[model samples]
Target: MSTGPAGHVARSTIRPHSETGVEGRKGPLRTFLSTWDGVRIDSVYEPGAVVYEESGTRSGRPGSPSGRDGLVFVVAHGFTGDADRPHVRRVARVLAGYGAVVTFSFRGHGASGGRSTVGDREVLDLAAVVDWARGLGHTRVAVVGFSMGGSVVLRYAALSRVGGGAGTGGGEVLGAGVDAVVSVSAPARWYYRGTAPMRRLHWLVTRPAGRLVGRYGLRTRIHHRDWDPVPLSPVEAVPRIAPTPLLIVHGDRDGYFPLDHPRMLAAAAGEHGELWVEPDMGHAENAAPEALLRRIGEWVVGRAG
Candidate 1:
């Protein structure tokens, strides 16, 4: 691993053993980058693959869009999850099979620094990662976020179009935009502690004791201040993401946000959005089957690639 001047770290090669006969000739280059807020984010980048058919024509893997270059997917994990989490890695692996993949730790999760703003301010983290992906030569970038991260992706897409920037510790502002988006199990509005998991999550983010638990027990730091200006909600942000293709995926059995949340987001998305209410599914990345994730990868490749 080598460290850049900005304290960015490039870890493992996306694919270390080309001699092993992997389908793709190359894989993503893994690295770390800092958010505008001075938060160091752990990130990975997978290189796109090309397969040649018997007709001597080049194409991507099945479920992937053909004849595209520099296609990339930026994956965001749920609250209490990090870049290295098993579920996050699973999603990344599936997406990587289609094209390049960039997965990162949101601030206050995994090896990243800074307290969790829940959905607010986390946009900076996503923006920084997206910027890094673009810098790595990805012509098309799509973002996939789950749960709290899902909400952040929705807001990020909306805010990016309006020149919204995240606050740095210094006076500088950083802005990053994306071409496509996928939100899974995201809440439409805030402060709805209806389900048991959400009620517990509310306590984890709201109470002092809960913050302490989050800090030590969960390794997630909760920001002390509440949203003063109250950032835009997911449903509200949906309309703003017009022309940017959107896919809202939620499990029919989701206990946290319920079916109404995805429905609300889909309704707000209007013509540009598609909704997948998966049967027998539960919540977030943990419950998303590999088949479902591959389908998501296909959607991203078809739209963004």
Candidate 2:
């Protein structure tokens, strides 16, 4: 175990690219990052091919922007996913072509502490990971989130722009350092139960039986309580992310959220965001193709500067 920025402990494992799905001379640097509220988040950093360095130490000092050097893609996975999940790793691997990648499990997911508040407080997790990427010598940081994570990236970008948010780290100032944001397969509003899949998901989160299945079957731990006062929705958050390049990608055939969800977000984004209606695409990271990931990388490379 080694010490990372802000005194966080990091463990580096040297595994083959075939095993990890991360292409690098050295394997990924795994660490536990502390959120502002003190939740220990399970995180991983993979150096991209373009910026691969063999440095023994990489995390930079906090608040020292001058020390930041490259572009880093911070990935927020969909519900029930952690950094080690194959789909999440694939997304990270593809985005790494443009720059380094930082992937983390949300609170209560994977090895992360606490329980999943779904998308409400997950903004804190994304904010902390983005800050970590910036501290790792990355001058530019872009967030790419899928499904439930997609809502989080949108909220995080808005919170960063708006200064502080309620229930998101106790109104803590957050997400200020983000350069760009991408939200794929996100919903427009909260409490959406338009489709059969969503109805089933609602049961899974709201019912005792579903939470039990989530923990034992899917390896996901969910919070028993519901959102009180409700956090800002994705549509409400998009209007505030001005001048920060925002990309909203949704599949035409997404089962969880239909095309209308992306449409609502796009309309709210106005001229500040770009919308892509992927043809024949399904949903989230599990359904994203390599070509789509490459296009996203290209967009980040062009806009994140």
Candidate 3:
């Protein structure tokens, strides 16, 4: 990556050891996400958790991607999912299998730093995590964000003409200079995320959860004034990531964002991004065929390797 106000710099990271990986070559990734039955975790940006502590192994034992680039994967959870959400953990484990260092945490869900920004300030938190991971010696980086987290990654990468540059800590604009991206049900419509039912049913459970997060001061924790979720949509972000490769996987039956979101992004990005519409999956579901995951993995390898 070019070095300037938005250049890459050295950061710190803590590495953990385990007994698993894709093809058993890259070792294992420590899963820092907590479980649903566990207590809520708090998010902190103070870098007090020891650059790279091996919090734990991802729950489901996912292997590395089919290819190898030694790039890191920063997985973001959904609107209702914390660092420990099953699906989130699954994505982490799978990316770890490919030998990529994976990370996800309870930004607002619990034990992370800062409250949820609905996707606004939380994107900065994601940038922090990416910086921390890069500090650990990762040269190439990829992002996999689900639902709301997905939108955050997209907006973070967009940077566009705002919220970029120095505010990102030493020129690291987007999550450690992402080499590739895969966003599942990333909200394309900020103004209508919750209001759109069929395309956003997965968020039906998130609406109440977001309000609960606000009760926990996530609104104040993330914003300076009034809080609104419309600021997190990817619809306007797709074209911002000019040369970066992207894989947008959307469910034909999504209940939150209209299918048009992915379609519009695809149309906007053209050859720069790939759009895949699942035939039978709902919003934020694990129903995406393994084939799609393989494509995403291959895409990362194609770009970063």
Candidate 3 regions off by >4 Å?
1-68, 160-175, 193-210, 213-225, 228-233
Candidate 2: where is the Cα deviation over 4 Å? 1-26, 51-69, 162-172
TM-score of 2: 0.83
lDDT, candidates in the order shown: 0.76, 0.78, 0.55
Writing each residue's lDDT as its tens digit, candidate 2 over 20-62 gives 2332224577777776656788888777655423352333222
TM-score of each predicted structure versus truth: 0.83, 0.83, 0.66
Candidate 3 deviation (Cα RMSD):
9.6
Q: How do the candidates rank by TM-score, highest first?
A: 2, 1, 3
| All candidates in order of lDDT, best leading | 2, 1, 3
- What is the per-residue lDDT of model 3 for residues 14-73, given as tens digits with 9 covering 90 to 100? 222332223333333443322122212332111111122134222233333332333567
Model 1, 3-82: lDDT tens per residue? 11233221212211113222233654555677655667777665555433446344665323233656678898999999
Give the Å shift of residue 141 in candidate 1: 0.3
User: Which of candidates 1 and 3 reaches a greater lDDT?
Assistant: 1
TM-score head-to-head 1 vs 3, winner: 1
Candidates 1 and 2, the one with greater TM-score: 2
Cα distance off (Å), candidate 3, residue 73? 1.2
Model 3, residue 34: C-alpha shift (Å):
18
Q: Candidate 2 has which clashing residue pairs, if any?
A: 69-137
